[model samples]
Target: MEIKEKITLDMLTKDSVSVLRQKFITLNGEDVQVGGNVRNDFTNCEDDRKILKEQLSEDYYNAVMAVWEV
Candidate 1:
């Protein structure tokens, strides 16, 4: 799914320690399976960052165009 939104770190870290521990398990690929909550959160964060960056670049271009037009 495409994420066209922004999310704060606090929103992602609501579970704090539990989320970190779960992420560690999945990162280590330890036979201990971590649920989709952590995975989806990471995915959404990454996708949202990409979308935000694109939006920022477009805004920058528009601002530069306005300056050049002036």
Candidate 2:
């Protein structure tokens, strides 16, 4: 999957943690595994972020996004 979307809180709501986790890792350039650390990685990514936004509900998405933020 290609990336370059500068991930936003709203950009993460679809893919499973496993998928997102992989993305988080690739974008981060490390295996820190910390949500906050990985989350920042997505900011420089693209395609995947677009795909992730249409999967989860707003509430569920917010909860998931919150994990990466904090």
Candidate 3:
């Protein structure tokens, strides 16, 4: 499924962790095999930061940062 809108790290404060996690997966096209896995858990701020910093592509990162800056 396609995401209706852009997502960002700021979503952590504005939306539920579950919602943000789903958006992250959608935006990044990640295959979530396990529901409760660490890679998909946005509740863990450290993990979220790591994914943003190390895993996500440049396009996705820039898109997220654009939303964050606004």
* Candidate with best TM-score: 3
Model 3 clash tally? 0
Query: Which digits, one per residue and each the tens of the lDDT, describe model 2 over residues 1-70?
Result: 2433223343543343432322233444743332432343233224534544575457644666565443
Q: Write the residue-wise lDDT of candidate 3 on 5-43 in tens digits.
A: 333333433222322323223435664332432323343
Which 10 successive residues of model 1 have the least lDDT summed? 14-23
Number of colliding residue pairs in each model: 0, 6, 0
Error of 1 at 57 (Å): 1.1
What are the per-residue Cα lDDT tens digits for candidate 1 across 1-70? Answer: 2222222232232122111223223234434433433322222344544543464456532433343332
Better of 2 and 3 by lDDT: 3
Better structure of 1 and 3 per lDDT: 3
TM-score-wise, the better of 1 and 2 is 2
Sequence-dependent TM-score of model 2: 0.30
Q: Which stretches of model 3 miss by more than 4 angstroms?
A: 1-47
Runs in model 1 deviating more than 4 A are: 1-56
lDDT per prediction?
Answer: 0.33, 0.41, 0.43
